[model samples]
Target: MTSLTPNTVAADAEGLTLIISGDGIGASSMLQWRGVDYPIDWIVDVDGDGGSLGSAIPASALAIDGTFETVLVTVSTGGAASNPLPVTIFGPGVGAAESAVAGAGGTVTASTGRLTATYTRAAGGYGTLTAVDYAFPTDPLLPPNPISPVAFVDLQLLDGVAGDTLVGTFLPPNPILPPNPVLPPNPVLPPSPIRLAYWTGTTWAPVSGSGAVAPTFSFDWATSSASSATVTFDMTSTPQITALGGTVIAFVSAFAFEGFSAPADSDINVAKAGRAVPLGWRILDLGGNPILNLSSSSVDVSSVRIVCESLSGEAEPLDAYAPGSSGLQNLGDGYYQWNWATEKSWAGTCRLVRFDFGDRNPDGSPIYRTAAFQFTR
Candidate 1:
């Protein structure tokens, strides 16, 4: 091969073509990655001699959590392998101090967490993009929904030219470790229901919608309701961000069944002294799969527990219900429910009652989805 065009790309990038401008081009020519030969997508030859050949990389083949990684690109034909050309595949999560995309000026960084994101600056991108701090620029650092956030990322940039765009795909790091942070994590595909919010000088809010919520940017969510999200940060309104070089922080929280549910995440429930209230939700893994235990009629009960706390954070365990009981049990397909019987002594008192689901993470960590509420009787 003589030359390769557009050899560099960010991790998890898609729909990109790699061009090879070399000699000995033939119909039998093919592209190879990781010793596996894939069919050439297309080719352009001149006078049947030497012309540019084209091949594409497999999906998610270049996805990585660390940067400065290199891959060798080669074209093979007639049982002979051409010389390997080094292609730089820049990754994310190389530490905040050293995290920068392979490009002219812009930089990107992410915090050390499972839920993370990687950014790609558009061709019209400009300016000095600095660090990615997980914070809100204004008061009420979080949104009103879900009560808390799984992770947050702030994209800091300045002097950005108009019409500059950025495509950021957010998912768990390592693609699958400590819980299998795999790209497009299984059972959870694109259109993942990931809750991404921006601090709108007051509270964390969603992108634009039909509710007259003024758009912060063009939200092109490629995935949702699962474990990943992709959005394009259109910098057409760069002025709104560059309030004297202030950073525009974007916060994201996944709506996986792993966190907050029962009284529906920070909600309040009214109960009678002798009434039974059902606390139930569909339990899901980080990847959005139902935690099924077909061996038993009920859902796995070993990981379920309940606790009650006072309004001032005084806590104590309450064994009102447990699995294999008369009224509390797993309903199957990862759904757990309990008809909580409110005792007469629990009436007229404000208490924070929480149900801790003992679902585990891929790394064997004691991960649990909790449902807490102000139980007022």
Candidate 2:
């Protein structure tokens, strides 16, 4: 004897259906997820119940709420039957209706935002199918789970419809500020006692260095004569010097004396001899090799200071070669002497002196001098 089994089954967002191909003699039954019997009425042309199938088993018998559920078809027949299989029923968030229609089965299920309809059949011939519609949830609600201020709000109703759109607006974070302001200028070097450039609002003009001073456009001279004249000129920010219109010349001349070398005085005889001349003098000639002169012409020694060294390596306090003490007072005029009597030395050692000059060329460059000698007993 042949058994009765479900040969076809179908489901949509609205409801589920099962078709059992009947054989010679057998009965078909519907099962639910709980393995319990679910009421089902046979579809027929004539009325069996009070009036129709609706009267025998209410539509609620096959209808599922907005919750996950499943149903199956079971057949009891001649020889043997397969195990009862279950087909899950998902909540119709997008399309749901009160009752099944003649064409679609039951009320349509509703859709949330961007949701697709999925229908499945199990233990039956029909396969699972999926359908998408632009229609989605209309009322947007915050995501079931959220993190920060930003969240995905699902729009209901409209989610299942085609060509539907979801739109929303939110404020962003604030802007950032700009950087700090700039500072002004402050002067350090003295304005005078030093040759300076002209003030040009922003910076000093006629800045001089590297072998030359700033440029001069004109020489405004208030001179008595070419030989003994004082020439004045305007030095611009540039270097090349020129006369305004006419040609003018001011000659600078000096006198010199050439002679033999000066005798080196004994360091011990400094007291009795009263003064001892320097190793070299400011002279035109000394033993043929020019003397280590001090002037704007050659050895331009500006300020001289004396430090005495002893044989024991101890040193004395530094003494300036001022006007009355040493002959260095007339730096440019004549020769001078450094005597041990006036500029005393420490007990065990002789004198070791070092000289320094301000701006080797009277134009700001460093110059240095050093000498050593032994005082007799």
Candidate 3:
């Protein structure tokens, strides 16, 4: 059999097509389709030629809603019979059709014409869903029905002092809410379980504190005017960040609805560090490259400070330094250094260091880092 497109065929609608080709049968050969030698009446060969035959079977002749293994035999005028070709068929209601796609950190699948979508963030970062489209052939009288409109979401990762949190805005299939109540509500229907997960580069792992827990992720319908609701992944209660980079996928499923979405290029950055100085520190980009030059006559530094917290939770603040400050030294190629003798007090304990760099561009956001560190004795 050349093609067995669908697992199940609708009795009143379209059926299956079987094509056969061989050199053993001649033009005068008779092609017979049967269930174990008992001929079936539904097989109609478009061309009666022997060497190759294409037959179309109607749904009504498939007998009942069950499995059918039909065999095709070709008998030539010379009394020679070709090898039997077996084809399997299933009646309507046997199985449903499914399709899916994935974004930066998400996936979507359809089962039996039902749609489901999911999103996850493994390394705890940001992501977004761009678009979604689907169609179904459920009704015989009408053309293939489309899911119409698309769904989207904006995911933001907030690494706060307390813990990490994933905030997501889920845009429904329809962006504009209907002023009149004639149209159905957004989401059409809410997906069940509203799962959040992280991609392990190989597979998806469910996020911690996902079910039956206080401070777990929650989805509400009226959180935003442009979305079904806002979904917040409570990373503070159960931290899910494992590495510096990875994706996240969230899944939502319902009887007639299912879909998934992933952020685009949602990779977390590993904080960069420079050569050490006695009680001093330097910060650089991932490539060991420094930020824009701050020592030039035209370049102005707004502010720079270091926040230190010891393992015992003792917090202290370091003095601000500028490019030409007394303990701050200008290193060639945009790199600068800061020295503070007071850092010696943070010895023998895990210390958390945060470096804040403010540039002259008032409108631009200041650069900051929490992962930078320098152990002191």
- From the highest lDDT down, the ranking of the candidates is 1, 3, 2
State candidate 1's TM-score.
0.35
TM-score of each: 0.35, 0.20, 0.20
> After aligning candidate 1 to the native by TM-score, how far in Å is the CA of 90 from where it should be?
23
Error of 2 at 254 (Å): 92
Candidate 3 structure, TM-score to reference: 0.20
| Candidate 2, 59-102: lDDT as tens digits | 34445442323344344334343344333343433222111001
- Give one digit per residue, the lDDT tens place, for model 3 in 275-330: 12222334332223443333333222232233434223323322232223244456
How much lDDT does candidate 3 score?
0.31
- The model with the greatest lDDT is 1
Provide the lDDT at 119 for model 2: 21
Residue 191's lDDT in candidate 1: 27
